[model samples]
Target: MNAVKTGSHAASTLEKTPVGDLVDGKGHSSGAEWLTRYSTSLMGVFGTPQRVLVRGAGCLVWDADGKEYLDLLGGIAVNALGHAHPFVTSVISSQLATLGHVSNFFTSPTQIALAEKLLALTHAPPGSKVFFANSGTEAVEAAFKLARRNGASPDGTTGKRTKIIALEGAFHGRTMGALALTAKEAYRAPFEPLPGGVVHIPFGDVAALEAAIDETVAAVFLEPIQGEAGVRPLPPGYLKAAREATTKAGALLILDEVQTGIGRTGKWLATEDAGIVPDAITLAKGLGGGFPIGALLTFGEQTSSLLAAGQHGTTFGGNPVATAAALATLHAIESQRVLENVAVVGDYLRTGLAAVDGVTEVRGEGLLIGFDLDAEVAPAVVTAGLDAGFIVNSPGPRTIRLAPPLVLTKDQTGTFLAALPAILRTAKDAQ
Candidate 1:
């Protein structure tokens, strides 16, 4: 790893300075001026950019002014192999140059191989099928349609089986069908009258789930660990109970592994720990190693004859470049034993964070960890972390989430751990 030793004192103060001052008044090249242009050119969904990162390698990134940070968030857990892994880069570049994309009506070796690999990892038994999409939301949407198709009555009463059960704090995606399943009212309210019949239930409440799910429901979709809701893991018996209840109700069980899969939880799929096979599994995030790709995996006969033949399609869903990147990502994780590293480093991170004062709770497994402060000081801690040359995120006002790359080393974890106390102290002082 390359270390940007611009002196700790200077680096600490740099974060507090305006980007304009750091750029020496160079117009377009200046970070502030470029951001000004960005504000004019781009939409305001993310608000103002926090930091203008220029480059990255492994688990570290350098800002516009050459300040380095230990990136603990890992691009919101999308960079599973970390930034610019050699294998990922090699596969993407080679495939792009050779045969980048093709129409969905066509097939490619990488696409078939990636689907086969996902089926194998899912342990979905032979003859399982996979559908490719461009993001987690698309994967969920595909599975949602499939479930609706499977739940249709012999009397052709598909419309009545439209209700789908989702958990509170679950985030499937921003698209219409996926947005319908996400429970956050803020995200759904903007586009009110979203696809009707989607119901939200409290996460981990088996009784509530049992009560809500009935013959009217087409599917029950949930995140194994609610990522955007702050790394909240489901209770021990909750997942099994959900599967049983959904099965009894004749509803499909869909597990959204977008943020929790691909060794982030020290397992190929976090649902493996539960020992219950969902009717469908949606995956993305770490799957492409930063390239864009998503997959929906279904087992046995539940694959559903949904959408007929020409009902749904995407222009770049299963492009060769993206498929190759995912294939390489899977190969690298297996060959390098990255899941074991996630387990070891995750334990270290959890133990380290638990030792901090004012940390009321530490939850989650593997590298997808979250902790609560005594107060709503997460934003302050984020600022302090940036000052201390680290990167992190707050999923909520009181919860700090750390979903670093699986390639994060012991030394990298130690750096953030060692700086955490001072970061907390700084946050506390601000109050």
Candidate 2:
């Protein structure tokens, strides 16, 4: 078989090929061809495509060129049960066939059931609530609104509390409201005059948190593990400390568990390990196991009632199909004992990664693993990993992140471990 082609020649070839010829599974188009067309037609925000993936199953995927890769990134922690999971797919299909969508005017049983299940799993108190959205950013946006709504004065008058606190390395999302809470100057600079009053404090600094949080503060947003910051977990006891400070200051403590929730950390929510029930938590990434569902769970009646009906809504947030997908995902996680698998396999991956020659350190819990290389060649490592039939990510110059499917097996992990040393060498050489 011919290797995938690239450059101007491939782009011209794609331009000449009939549009109908690009049909899926036909093997009539190459990765380079699809990517060239993609560059011309799509936005440049994400840059060029690495490989044009055609199909996926479990923890593996195939590019358009018929190349197979062990998907170690798991779509950046979105594909919890891995790509095209049978159970999730079936549920979504069935729901779509039966009743695909309904406006916010009416709610479906599946949607209600999912909300109830999330509340139960999080051990939320009576009168707690769940607000559904279509993505992590949407969920964060809703949480932002909830925080603002809860920002009322001690006597319940509006506008007294306006400030919101987020960590320095935090990545909430790219949407306006979510972006305002995000700390990266680059992401926020482009869109200036963002909804103000959002502050950034040093991550994992309890003293800083205590000093920054006050009556004027409406909420403190935290990610138990910062996935985009290279899977950096918060310092021990930080969650509890934040909880205490926020409670003392009468501010809400919101956990952004977009990448750490839904059993990604060997538990339903990473904050659970810290034994703190936050005022609100935003969840996505793995919630629907690649089906694109997000939610904000409020812990009690007061916080839950902050956003009254008509205050916030989404057209397709809790559509029957999405709810069904989320429900099926939860069912699979429980029935398959995937959380147990995450604990056992996660430890294995971490241990094996630490032993790799070029590895400097490993951080993260469950399947969401990240490691630092002795040398700053993470981008090169990602390239080498792809070339070696393994899919990985470089969140930073020195960090390689792995948030593979929760169902990833020990043997599959062993396969990557066996090949990592050579991939590292190749990366260093290329660098």
Tens digits of lDDT, candidate 2, 191-293: 9999999999998989999999889999999999898899999999999999999999989999999999999999998888697879999999899989989
lDDT for 236 (candidate 1): 86
Clashes found in each candidate (C-alpha, N, C closer than 3 A): 0, 0
Q: Cα lDDT for residue 364, model 2?
A: 97
Query: Where in model 2 is the C-alpha error above 4 Å?
Result: 1-27, 153-157
Name the TM-score of candidate 2: 0.93
Q: lDDT tens string, model 1, 308-382?
A: 676567888989999999999999999999999999999988998898888999999899999999989999999
TM-score of each: 0.91, 0.93
- Global lDDT scores for all candidate models: 0.87, 0.92
Clash pairs detected, candidate 2: none
Q: How many backbone clashes does candidate 1 have?
A: 0
Instruction: List candidate 1 segments past 4 Å from native.
Output: 1-28, 153-159
